[model samples]
Target: MTTISQTAGYTDLQTALKVRARNPALDRLRCFLTLVVLLHHSVIAYTYFGHTDPKSWIGFDAIILSTDSFFMATFFFLSGLFIWPSLAHKEPWIFLRDRLLRLGLPLAIAALTIIPIAYYAIALRRAPHISFADFWWTTVTVGPWPSGPVWFISVLLAFDLAASTLHRLSPKLVDPINRLSLRGYERPAVFFVFMLIVTAIVYIPARVYFGASRWFEFGPLSLQSSRVLLYPVYFFIGAGVGAANFDRGLLSADGRLAKSNWAWIIAAMIPYCLLWVLIYMKREILGNPVWLPDWYEIIYGLLFAAFSAAILFAILAYFLRFKRLGSSMLDPMQAAAYGMFLVHDPIVLWLQYWLFDVDMPAIAKALIVFVLTVLLSWGATAALLKIPGATRVL
Candidate 1:
């Protein structure tokens, strides 16, 4: 039987042949995750900090946290999984070039077009006196403005650069990591323990000291960091798993693997739901604690991370089981996922401004903005992708 890699236009002949199926299930998973991200950011825009009334209650803040983290974690993991097969066979320069086109170009476009537009909307809402010239100057020439979700691209690039450096310095490191990952696949318990330990060791100090800021002032280096250590660890884990062909049964449909995946997913949700409730209670009753202890943050964060991974993987596995489900209509929406990531912030910001004067409940206003942003983002992305060169990365 011909494998996926043998399919025309499916495999890169120039790269090492790591034969894996395209798995439409995974593509659908990506599309769903992107929507989750859109929802999370849309909620953020309509919440108090952006434009919603301070007393307004959106009922979505709690759900947003889990969705954002899980969506991003899955995105990074999938990215890492794709990387190893490409890097293992391709020349280093070629690999870097492809990454640059895919990640860097989108970032540049976001910074110039999407981010500035979002800032303009924000300025109009918060300070109507601000002129177009001033807003453009502030967004473009000034300091690092929060470019909404495009921050993920910057962080991912940083991680990729670090990985590249390691590869350059210690060429033998990749082989050993791959071997270790293969061994861990055989012993799932050990792999889980290692992941937990690594999460604690790397995340604890970073979170406590860094305080969740993306841009850190570390002398000349000016460390652009976010998610502390969580993202890099997940990215590397993905690469390792890909290299070693460690399936984790996430794509498997039959027998023990399927059963185990479902069981673990349900088990994982217990802790996730509990932690979320605890967090809500702590905020509501105890009042926001001024300083969270390192131990508490580490434990809670690690638990959330694990639960998020389990939930996402299980969902993917279950969906993959139904082969006919992949026949759904493909739209420009699939191509627009990246563009939406870039453009949605502006769309949301603008929508929030327009909805500000409307006398509606917070939940109602949020829903309105959410729907509007989705439509606007979809439209904008479609238009952007039609332009020359823009379609390449987005």
Candidate 2:
């Protein structure tokens, strides 16, 4: 028979293990990305290059360009970082059930309610008297259902399932990448180059084939054609890094990757500038043709992939380096971040709709939208978490 002291020791050990499983740096990084998502949508309507609002600014164009280039791919990579470990610990059925609750439930709910409400703001711009009843009915029953940002949730769930299946089939498949991650602790640039090459291989041909504006869509499911494979490449690379010896791998706090943050920033800037150069060539030199040439697409795609990979390393390095610097504004919002992401689109779109005629500068309107969206969405998530058993899904 076990003594009470022994049982208590066992319980404490289990608690410590659970706490150790959670990474503080990654948590804060995730929170920061959630805020980025809000800011991206809030200012997108005001970008001078793709202005949807009465007021527009070139600065917002730069902001959107960087965020659009890497944020979603980074999100998928961050998500993949824990997949192998998760599948190792949980029973397959248990893993699936939890993923369904966390991802699938939010996806279904958001697609049916939040997404329609959000897009309706745009619909009203086109047709002022369109009733919500008519719009919702047509959106679900007929055609043109958009998933909004919740498409990330649906796609992430699919990737998780595929990863689990792959893991069960051949546990050692990601061993090569894991080995590279271990080596990255000493020479981070090698890992960086590897990711750049892989992403370019998967993304360039697709960009040339799809021409950058096409999306594969069905009801509430949609993915950008050029990026459909790029995301999974990041996903699996992340999985490989976390597959084994995670604490000793590329992202280790003491690793060269974290120590060399400035280098990654420079790496990111070069390709980003080249990207703008390509944009200039398209508009001024190439006359903004309906279809850009294959040579142009190939060059643009390679630069985009390089920028994406470099920026990801830069961000992870920054977070890992300063991870021990104690509490942050981001800490308080970390738990609420996912809920905020799910709920913010409607709040932001509605705010933009209301502010359309406010007679303000582009920056001022964007500022107002961003601040209010953060506050309202954070408050809404807090309230939603108060409902009985809501925390499980949220």
Candidate 3:
């Protein structure tokens, strides 16, 4: 029943989707997020809430709060954007193999090697004389096996597995979301509101029940309890957006979503400011309770969810708006970004440990750590990529 013209249209759409899938804008965004991750860790030690050294800055607390609210969730969304297309192209077994090789292998390798090395700096601060062997044994064998940032990797692999199973059962499961994405082409605010509601629904209850600081942890496997469902919401929504017709959907470079960057910036700033107001209330008005009331948790959670959604849209729009200007500063690190993410924790940690005793102001120490961590991690990733057959995994 298909006409020649119809077939041609379909083919053209497919080609466009392929091009969009490989969009430089998305790559640049991922690289920017990676840098944000580095910046986040670089400054956390200096934050008022998490001060591990003599110097502490309230400014870093604001930065941490904003970054923590959005970055990992956005990373999951980006990871999901490519999943359905990848699955459509490869055999199930091949897809599984690739996911395992890329995600599983890194997780296993990092948990054993990189994680212990990074945590050793923290351990050294406490015991100062504790041997690496002793620290490693206690960490791996005894308890509190910290995964650092690679928890995201482990959880992502699990989501990929779940997605594979769902795809096998019904490829159309996400069709409704894809349809909504198409609608987003004209009215991105609709899509934004949808994501805000969904993320808030999933995130708020768990946050109120589990509180913010709780993590479900077991020997190198850990996740923030509240985010367990929140991340999957973002991931599956991204999958829906990317399920098909990626080039023509909400993220189309020419779409209103791209043109509406400023709207989202305003949207993001409102909730972000409100979040700080709540923070002030928690500390100044509520006496900084050990556990905030459920009402406080609910309101904070909603604001966090709103801010996250708006910022995601804003960042995506910013990139898409400038996507045609061609190669970016972020381009140079595109290939190495993943490797940089995997390896940056230890570099940042050790750099902080070295700078811990320095008499510099908090901002000075943080900048020194941030600049050095970026250079070192980039160099480390570049060197790693030179290894034979490393590109496939890195």
For residues 1-394, could you state the per-residue lDDT of candidate 2 as single tens digits?
A: 0000001111111121231475678777887888888899899989866587899988988988898898888887877777777778778998798888877888899999999999999899999999999999999999699878877776778888998899899988899999999999999999999999999999999999998888888899888889889988988998899788988989899898889889999999999999999998998999999899999999999999999999999999998966677777778986677788889988988999999988999999999999999999999999999999887776
lDDT of 1: 0.59
Give one digit per residue, the lDDT tens place, for model 1 in 1-394. Answer: 0000000011111122446655555555555656676677666644432334432664565656556546666666666655556665667887688668766776777767777777687678678999877887775666445455666676667666676766667644555555655554334444555655665567656656654434553211233343556767777766665654445422334423334556657756876777777576557875867666666566566666566656655665565554446464433355666666667777777777777777777778777877887788789878877889876566
lDDT of each: 0.59, 0.83, 0.84
Per-residue lDDT tens digits for candidate 3, residues 142-246, read: 867988888777788888899999998988899999999999999888999899999999999999999998888878878889887998898899889988888
Candidate 1 local Cα displacement, residue 32, angstroms: 0.6
Stretches off by above 4 angstroms in model 2 are 1-20
Candidate 1 TM-score, C-alpha based: 0.81
* Model 1: worst 10 consecutive residues (lDDT sum): 1-10
TM-score of each: 0.81, 0.94, 0.95
Number of the predicted model whose lDDT against the real structure is largest: 3
lDDT of 2 at 170: 92
Candidate 1: pairs in clash = none
Better of 2 and 3 by lDDT: 3
What's the C-alpha lDDT at position 181 in model 1? 54
Check candidate 2 and list the clashing pairs.
none
